[model samples]
Target: MARLFNRTTQQGSRTSLPMATTLPMTLFMALQSRKTRYRSTLVVLAVLLCLSTYLLARSSSSASHTLLHKDMPSDDQMPVVFEEASHSHVSGTARKHRKVHKDREQVTLDPSQELAAISSFLASLPQNVIPLSVDPSVTVDPQLVLDFDTRSPRAAAEVQHMVADVWLRNPVFLYSKLYSPASREVKAMLAKMDLRPAPTIIDVDIRDDAEVLEPIIKRLSSSSDLPVLLIGGKPVGSMKEIRLLDKSGELRKLVAASGAVVDGSKKKQHKH
Candidate 1:
């Protein structure tokens, strides 16, 4: 009976040892499977993070490129606009200068036309306005005398003393042929002015005294013209220069300086 009890206890101990070994193996396998699942989850999270970073970087680059393009003007359009503005400014400046030049040209006068106008004015004078001859008997101021060549045509002689009354109250010496359209115009201009004394007229024949007349005319003018005004024993210029001086108000001062009396009242009247 004792032997039977000992055999039964040994069989139970062997069965308990097998059960403990199997439990430890099963627990180790379960731990290994849990570690594998954790590794797979970490790999999937890393991939998602990398994809998200790439997408964010691409979007940022695209936005920067769009902003750059929007801020700057196109190369072709910019140059064309600037060039057109520059050309328009230059053309406007050039046109202004041309207009100013044209205005200056319009105010200028022709020399020939001025001379023709003077001639026309002389032809319109009244026929009855004849200059009186200078009398040798009267004592006259030599400075006031306007000398003329006697050899000129009779028409030239008629106009020599026309302005003598107004320009000089003393006397005018006429050589034959001293009359001309210029002289007539000068005389008519003088006659229109208020003067004190009518100028005395004297006629001298150049044929009789050519030697005396030649020196006088040469001293007064470069050419042997019909009429020459001598003031203070000096030549004043031709009719054109006289007209210029008169218009400028310089002739009155010059004549007054030469001991010729100008009508102050007439000058004031003309100014008004």
Candidate 2:
């Protein structure tokens, strides 16, 4: 029996040069019990790797998309890409989007500036009324004349009455109606204003050009010793200077406030 026990202990103690190492009982038992969990973990990891690869391939399909993805700017890096544009530029849709944004920033949105510009444009038209606010405290100089040579039929009549009402009442302000008579249209029209003629009417007919304008200028400048403003060859008044612009009213009011007078007339009477 002692000889049999000695042989059994030697067999158990001897380590063998086996193909695979044998696990201890505790480790072997744990692996055997959790075999299903280990298999499931491996399968899930393989699926995640395959999905990530497929998504990357799908995003790089287009050439532009591929370029955008490569060397992309992160929040911690530069945002703008300013590469020299090759002959091949950005898509037409991208250019149009940039232009639309630029034009929106350039447009002026103020409502009052638009309205004032329109009003000033309309006021410059023929027969458009100008409200003459006279400080009657200013004694009128008889040398300054308001002359009308408007070619429009309605304009001549409208201007005649407008100037007369203001000029005739003043002690020294005077007015005259000067125009061509080649047309019976003008003659028939002038007959309407004379319906209530005052002694203060001075009518001059010019068949020639600004030869008529020259004399009127000479008369006003010689008589008043003041600057004369002409409108289409008719002497309008004594003014320091005339400026032509889209918004003459603002400038005119500025001049008036500074005690300087301005005439909006387009023509300038020749100064001797």
Candidate 3:
């Protein structure tokens, strides 16, 4: 109403009697109820204040997020300035393609030095004795079968040497195992050493001595041109014995009596 009156006044308008008179009374009554009106307005104002506070908090949070995430300057303006600064930090480096040369080594050997070295090595070992404990009548075949297991330490070592020797001369010589264990080692023993005189020997250990002895005797007597020397009551094979006799002296008469060539003074005495 005051605004209305002020507008009216500004327009230079005159108020009529009825409006002029009623306006004062209405204004007076409104003024008298001003406390009640003010209280109702205060309640509405408080609700509006709460709504404003919520809007302000929301706006503040939105502004904070925008400030946190975005560049500080306005969108239309340059956001940041940059400068290419010199970074002259000191550093050390190593190269990979490096070459190194090594000198040639010298090899030297002296007769005295070699002799001393051999003597030293030989001195470390005990005497090499071919353990001659096995029986010679075990088997006629090179495959030595005895009453002893060849796996025993003494037997294995001896047999290893014997088999090696057998192969060294007659590679056809073979080996076999025994089913039982006895004092005899089959490897060191032979049916007839006179065939091949092996220094590494196994003595006779035949269970049935006669059975073994008879066969050897028969082989000897069956041949007219063969004479075998029986040593230790065991008949030796003339196949090996004859070759040995040719190399030794006394065996020439036996070699001649058999009507075989006496490879002794007779061989030299006979004309070509």
Candidate 4:
């Protein structure tokens, strides 16, 4: 009995010794695992912080750009003088100030009155000057191409009559615009020549039928330019042609040939 009890006690002590050793090893492995997880969490936080900072910086820069753009002025908001300067510099063409007709009375005529006026002006021209037929090679001004298809039949007819009265029927016609520098220059030049039975200067821009008349004038002149000069119902030319004619001393001859008298002491004067 004593020997059996000693063997049982030895086996129990062996089992307890192994359990005590394994418990400390398990605890050490658990502590190492927790430390590794904590390190990984810290690295993840650092990366997130860097990413957040970069995003914030990008957003701030975008916001600043937006604000700057919003503060910039649009073309419409710019001063008139500045706008004028910009436009004048675009084609290097000198922009003359509109100085004519500031004190002149405004004349508005009805369709019938307009027709009568045109007829009277035609009658006043010397009998020797006749309406010349348009040249076929000269393309009609695209502006004069009437969109009769869109207009009421009656409206279209009225416009047609007006166009004929102004361009086709009249022997002397000056197609101009109120604000055009070239038109003003042409007028100034014509004034100096003192053409007898002066050409009717129609400022299409100020006409009530501007939408229709403007295009017709453009088409009849076969040009998109302002200040179309017509003599004997034929296009004499725009400002450029007039200048050329004047330079060569042929303008007076052309005017006289059209049965118009040029009598002005200021005939020798020219526009710079």
TM per prediction: 0.29, 0.15, 0.15, 0.37
Cα RMSD (angstroms) for every candidate in the order listed: 26.7, 22.9, 34.5, 17.2
| lDDT of candidate model 3 versus the reference | 0.35
Candidate ranking (lDDT, best to worst) = 4, 1, 3, 2
Candidate 2 Cα deviation (angstroms), residue 114: 20
Q: By lDDT, who's the top model here? A: 4
Candidates' C-alpha lDDT: 0.43, 0.33, 0.35, 0.56
Candidate 1 ranges with C-alpha deviation above 4 Å: 1-178, 197-215, 219-221, 264-272
Error of 4 at 24 (Å): 99
lDDT score for candidate 2 against the true structure: 0.33
Looking at model 4, residue 141 earns an lDDT score of 21
Q: In candidate 3, which residue ranges exceed 4 Å CA deviation?
A: 1-32, 71-272
Candidate 1, residues 179-222, lDDT tens digits: the string is 45766665655554433333222222323333443334443345
Query: Candidate 2, which segments miss by more than 4 Å at Cα?
Result: 14-228, 231-272
Q: Specify the poorest-scoring 10-residue window by lDDT in model 2.
A: 93-102
TM-score for candidate 4, please give it: 0.37
For candidate 2, the TM-score is 0.15
lDDT of 1 at 95: 14
